[model samples]
Target: MSEHNEGDLFRQFVGDVKPLKQTVRGDKRPAAKDTPGLIERRRAAQELGNKEGNYLARQEHISPVKPWDLLSFKRDGVQHGVFRSLKQGKYVIDATIDLHGRTVQQARQEVFHFLRECVERDIRCATITHGKGQHRDPPALLKSCVNHWLQQMDEVLAFHSARPQQGGSGSTNVLLRKSQAQKDKNSEKFNRKTSRK
Candidate 1:
């Protein structure tokens, strides 16, 4: 082949390759800014979380209880017999919340919400299973927290560690105050008299 013909063939092969104008780091489009509606929605959600978190004390410190210890409480005016029933796990548990794998913050929020909902639904008896917490540094961390927090809630009329069959020291039996509707229903039941002719 003549030198000119060979050069023409090389040019034809190389013609498509061009020098890069700039090195591309990546997709360089401007960062997307959050929309105003999305920002407002996030803010509202955060506020709701804060409000709910306030219901239970998250940082308050109390002396830790032993993992094997039993937890019990009874507000004034709660009859001894009723408290005994609760201690004996005699009342049918209407609901239960298990905090076995939850962090302290999670357990706090769950306990507060659970008790509130139970009261609203007229749940007279409930169980809270806060694992022994034996592996934690403070020991019985969740159990101790549950013990203190339940004392603060007015809705909790009484509480006691569960029986062996229930959950032993790892769980608690709670007696909640009656809702207004429940109170009215009970009153009606007691006040109504049957008339037979």
Candidate 2:
């Protein structure tokens, strides 16, 4: 009974007191600066990007496959009928570029840039009119350059001389490989069709 009474007295004594405030911290370390190695690495990456950007902005060297001659190539393992279809002008031409009288340098840049855009837009078939170099003493300078450049790019699946209505041998019809996105979309459709069946 005495112990219970003492306990009640102690609780009453402690109940009215306020709690103490917490101590706020005053000192904090500042954020870390980049180390010397990190800074050097960042600078090197930036310089490389600038160099590549400059290379793209200016002339890209084009090695002619063969000067002033019919030029053609296809990456190996392409299905046999694909090239033949292009040669037959079976694919509808989705885009066209005329390179008449442009310098080889200008034509090279334009052709690459245009083809890049075409692939992005999912264009598969295009016609490039390089002109037969008819009036030139040598003949077919742009034609040859265009041919060589097209062969060099992996995007070009096949090309052949267009018919009389399409500028004949002077202008080549090009078949570009389908973009990966386009191919994936087609595969998805195929899968869906098979799944339904």
Candidate 3:
């Protein structure tokens, strides 16, 4: 082909290959001015303050009685009825009391001693794994005895059948009276830790 003809053909090819440019026009609404409702809402929210508007605000307005704020022993008195179901943690004792192994008198002393120790240790909650007395033919001697013993103990705030995860009906969950030192230490620890954190 001739140079002039080839140059014209190349120009035509370049023109055809080039893509068309596009411009986008946006149909946007104008920025909204502050309406009366919006202004009022802002004013009301600000006027309400944190304390007036929120549920937690009311809680803050009224002095809260923290778990550690009240006297442990005094608070325990009020919680005497509800504590059994409320507390679920474990306080295990290495020593086990077997009713079958001991005489009636010995068993009574053992029960008293165990309860006293629990109170002294400031153990709010503990489990007495009194075996279900499966071997006892007619009735569960240990189970019945533990129930009776717990009922008699003044220091036993409350007692109930333990959760299935925690020995189930075989064990009794016992809530005991808090000792002075335990109560004080717990309150001090809670105050120090909770306030700072």
Question: What are the C-alpha RMSDs, in order, of all predicted structures?
Answer: 15.1, 21.9, 30.0
Error of 1 at 34 (Å): 28
**lDDT tens readout by residue for model 3, 5-55:** 999999988976867689786796565676899567545544444434222
- Runs in model 2 deviating more than 4 A are 1-70
Winner on lDDT between 2 and 3 is 2
Model 2, span 10-47: residue lDDT tens:
98999898899999886965646768995675456446
All models: lDDT?
A: 0.85, 0.73, 0.55
- Can you write out model 1's per-residue Cα lDDT over 14-68, one digit (the tens) per residue? 9899987997788656755768995675456446557875466564675578999
Of 1 and 3, which scores higher on TM-score? Answer: 1
CA deviation > 4 Å runs, candidate 1: 1-49, 191-197
* Candidate number of the best lDDT: 1
TM-score of each: 0.70, 0.63, 0.45
lDDT of 3 at 36: 100
